[model samples]
Target chain A: MALKHSVSGFLADRYDMETATGFLRKQAGKRLPPHTSWLHVFGSLSLLLFISQTITGIMLLIYYRPTPDEAHKSIQYITAEVNYGWLYRQIHAWGATLMILAVVLHMTRTYFFGAYKKPRELTWVSGVLIFIVTITFGFTGYLLPWNQIAFWATTVGTESANKIPIIGEWLRYFIRGGDVVTGETLSRFFVVHVIILPWALTGLIAVHLFLMRATNLATLEPVGEEKPIEPKHGIPFFPVHVCKESIVAVLLLAVLVTLSVLAPWEIGEPADPLVTPEHIKPEWYFLPSYQLLKYFEGPYGAFFGIVACSVPFLLLFLWPFLDRGKHRHPKKRPIAVGIGLVGLIGALVLGYLGHVSETEQTFFGTRYHIDHYGVPHRVADKSRDEGE
Target chain B: MSNRFLGNTEMNEPTPQPTRRSFLDWVIGLFSAVTVGAMTIPALAYFWPAAKGGKGGDVEVKEAANLKPGESAIVQLQGKAAIVRRDASGLVAYSAVCTHLGCLVKWDGARKEFLCPCHAAVFDASGRVVSGPAPAPLPAYKVKEVSGKVFVSTT
Candidate 1:
């Protein structure tokens, strides 16, 4: 008791500890809906990953040279020379992937629970904004490595951004800071990645959290019931919810570390503007859209492709208003659930398709020999270099 | 908040004792605790940078004088198994990572083929998959003998 008093006294002397503690206690005591499970952990997990990324990103920045000529060399120095630099770099890279995934799952969970209806509309909107910002962060960060894959992937990524009909050319030029991806583009991306996006995302996240806490927590049932059910006893946010959150964060961090240790992130050959790789692919998160664009050709195709890709985001943003049915149970909402399932399955299929090489087939012997690209060609007419 | 007829202690119901439900709870709690501990230790270690080893770059596997015709040696090339074989033609090196799922491939001297134990995928002397579920031929690395030392470089 004496030790606690001294520590409390010291903290109080240094700051407004009492008031801060009171505020925290009040926030912790907030009543959270019952039936909270592992599905609800994604938001906190994403936040944890975001925090990890921020710390590791700052560590990387100390050694990372943003200049085009020096960037790749600087990265190599960090990986090969700096103490624990490889760990930090791998954590940051893997963290970004995991953060994106967590955010997606969190959003999906929100949708599944119909948590976006009515009072939570602003929170949902802010979450969607954060999702966009996160993806943008990924797009900007990919080029910082300044490797061959990064260079070509950025070129392909920006080229696709150029397919946005009227604003296509301007958007491309704006992103690159010139007609081509050169030193200027690198500088622009570096500044945006390190400074601009972080600030914007932080501000947006603050608002998101504020909105989330300001409203009552959504439950399994839809709001606006004609005959209200008996109010269920809510669990306190402090000890109960916080304990679960900590457990999830710790487990996730452990998993992230294991992955980092097992497979240290690879740095491909340094960027050579003169050469484009035989096959270029963007980061996996963007695969669905990339695959979508491949099926279409010409200006009209590009226009339609852009529209098709935009539809999901549009639907997501407008979901609360779109799904106005009284029933929140997934079984009762067949149409909504079916649509979500289709979108998920389509994304998965497209993601897989995007990573694979497309090859044409030619008639061969009964036991046809498949080529490198999975294309079959006749052994009788096999050329010296038929497929890649 | 007073209950009626509380004085009649003999009529009161007996308090429920712990049952199989409590036992199940204890089992789950113990399992969860173990799982959490198991995850935490390795995760903490993973944060530290792995020790640097001379594995990935140009690694000298064997001496040219020691390896005769039809002889093979499994060398750790960049933390992956690589087989260096000396035949009548010259020295050849093939990646030991199987094409199917990256299981380490083993050299079979009698059969003269590289075999994956995971799924029984087989690669011939040239690192081409002869049978099973492997999708692509094993990657071949360039091998050079300089001053009687065989150096293998992964391209």
Candidate 2:
């Protein structure tokens, strides 16, 4: 008892620990909506995946060489030689993909439940920014391995920035740090991936979480429905909500570990600027936008495709205002629900098309054939082999 | 007086002990704690830095004479497959990792080229992609022949 008293006294003297504990307890005691369930756990799961990615990424940075010549070689060393290095790298890689997936799930849940309306506009906007930051994280990290696919995909990915009207070329040069993808590009991506992205993402996520806690989670029931009267209707954030989130995080970790163990991440051949791969495709999450661009014809088409695809984010940002109804239920908002479904199906279909690339078409008297491997080869080119 | 402070007039009656609700909470709380601890430990260990060592030193593949003219032997070099071939020109060692995706490539004697089963990417005798999806030639390692013994260095 004396020792306990002394420890408490020390904490109080040094840090005024009682006040801090009271503040934390107040925050933790906040009551969540009674209707919260498994679906509500996705946002926390995304945060968990983000933390996992950051930890594993830091581990990889210990052995990862950022220069073009040594980047791929260093990855090989980490995967093949270092202790549990393969697991670390695989977790980081798969964590990125899973994080994006969880973000989508969370966003869809929010939108369908009309949680973005009123008092939560900033929260939704911040969530959209988080999504963009997450994808940008994926894009910048894709080039770090300095492998064939990483090089070519990054080249193509950044080239899209060139499709902008006036500042296009300048933006591309600024991103690449030169006219071409070189050592400069690798260093730039490494800095952005390791330093800039994590800091920005953490700031945005903090704001998002702050706004969420301040506003409180939306109930699953519509606004007109009666709020439960009993004290048990709502749950405290400390033990109840936190424990549920913990369960979800554990499940997510299990999936990630299985993926990391069963199919460890592999680094492709070292990047050779002189040789471009026959089939160059960006990571899976970028496929929808990639296919959307292919539908258009020329430089102008690329711009149009980009603008069209980006319209959804703009709409999503302004959704609270655009969807000016007080209803939180889906049935009451038929048009919004319809549009959301259409957008989801369109994205999935476009992603599929991008993956298969098995389209042969004659556009303006030119025969264009995209093989199954996403390799675009001209049918009229007699010099090329028939099989590819 | 105690009931007033407790915010429940029914507290004077009696608090339930070992109820089904409390038991379920304990079960779930224990399970969650165990599962989360299991996941977090490995994740934290992965973040802890270990000794950094190079895996690129020279490795003795096989006897020089075993890799005869027009014959190729797939040898493991630091956990990656490598092909040591003796052609009409000279002895050359190439990484047997397919340039397309890092799948281990196999030496097809009849075809006399390395074939990747993952994607049909073919590398010719000198590691150049003759046909298929491979983008670049297979990476070649420095080969040294000393007293009928062959060694390859990826460094």
Candidate 3:
């Protein structure tokens, strides 16, 4: 007790300990808006996933080699040789997928609630920016595995920039660090995924959180309307809201562990620039865009495809300004809700198409071959002849 | 003492003179700019991708007799992907890097075409774009057959 008092006294001499503790306690006691629901957990869940990713990513980095020559070999070593290295790798991989999912869900919730209105415009803008950065994090991180899919997907992903008219070629060269995806490309991506993107994301998340705190969570109140939160009437941030977040975090960890244990991520064949994989598909998140780009062919197709893909992102970023509606409820704003649904459905359909493209699959009784353009063509079933 | 530090006449006159604080500010500004430039210039240069290694020279693919007709071998020419194919006419070579994207095109000996797997872009035996999204044909390289050995020029 005497030692504790001395330590506290030493700290108190340099800092206002009482005031700091009081301030933290006040923040913890702050009340959330009355309308705050279970749906709001997604944002916190995304944060949880990001934290888990950072921890796992750091652990994986201990053995990961950025060079193409050793990248795949290092991953194999980590998975098979090192103890629990596979667990860290799997958690990081699953964490990325879950993080993207959580971010999308959070954005969807925010959109449906019409939370991007009036004073909360900046918050919405920052949130959208964060979402874009998060997607980019996924894109850059996908290539770190240095596998066949990583190589080809990055090839296709970077090559898509070649449609940007005059600067396209230079841009591709810049992105790849050369004429082709080589060791240099791997180095560049490793630095970006590990260093540049993390810093960028941290800054973006800080800004987002700051804006959200400043504006407070958007209630179901109409635009330009504010319902003052009362301490007794609303949910207390401490023990109540924090408890909910804690439960979600625990559940998220359980799911991540379950995924890591059930299906550990495989380190596929190392990247071969010379031998392109026959079926090179990007991660599921990029499927919608990948399928969409297939439709745009020829000289002008790439340019148009780029524009088509960019339109949605542009719209999403500028949504706060575009949506001049007074209503916060989905029922009140029919047009906005309809457009949102259409986009959601369209993305889902495109993703499904992408999943099935360049492959033969039997849906119901008919065997259909989905081509590069994601167009289904009925083909004669050959499975009966070679049936089990 | 103040009057002695600044000449008595100068102190009496209300002339605008550079203060020590302003002088220090200017020095700090210059140092800051120099410091930033010192850091930024190297960083900017770092992003400008490493230069391709080695001077352009003849890279030996294999023995001219080794590669039979309709056979192709992908080799590194001056640190870039290059393909050497033996045809009925003669030994021909082209940069294997696809014109559509940077994917290395596989030599389809049966079809006698260079096939890019990324976007299904096809190039004929002559490195001409036959179909698909490739805007240009694969660039040809000079193949020299000397002393029973085939060499692809990287210049």
Give the top-scoring candidate (lDDT). 3
Where does model 1 exceed 4 Å of error? Answer: A1-19, A226-232, A359-388, B1-155
Better of 2 and 3 by TM-score: 3
Q: After superposition, how far is residue A293 of candidate 2 from its true place, in Å?
A: 0.4
Model-by-model lDDT, in order?
A: 0.77, 0.79, 0.85
lDDT score for residue A297 of model 1: 43
Native contacts, share recovered per candidate: 0.00, 0.00, 0.46
TM-score of each: 0.65, 0.66, 0.89
B-chain TM-score, every candidate?
0.60, 0.61, 0.79
- Per-residue CA lDDT of candidate 2, range A274-325, in tens? 4455556678899998777655533265577668778878988888789877
TM-score of model 2 (CA atoms): 0.66
Measured by DockQ, the strongest candidate is: 3
Q: What pairs collide in candidate 1? A: B55-B78
Q: Tell me, by TM-score, which candidate is best.
A: 3
* Candidates, ranked, lDDT: 3, 2, 1
DockQ of the two-chain complex in candidate 2: 0.02
Clashing pairs in 3: none
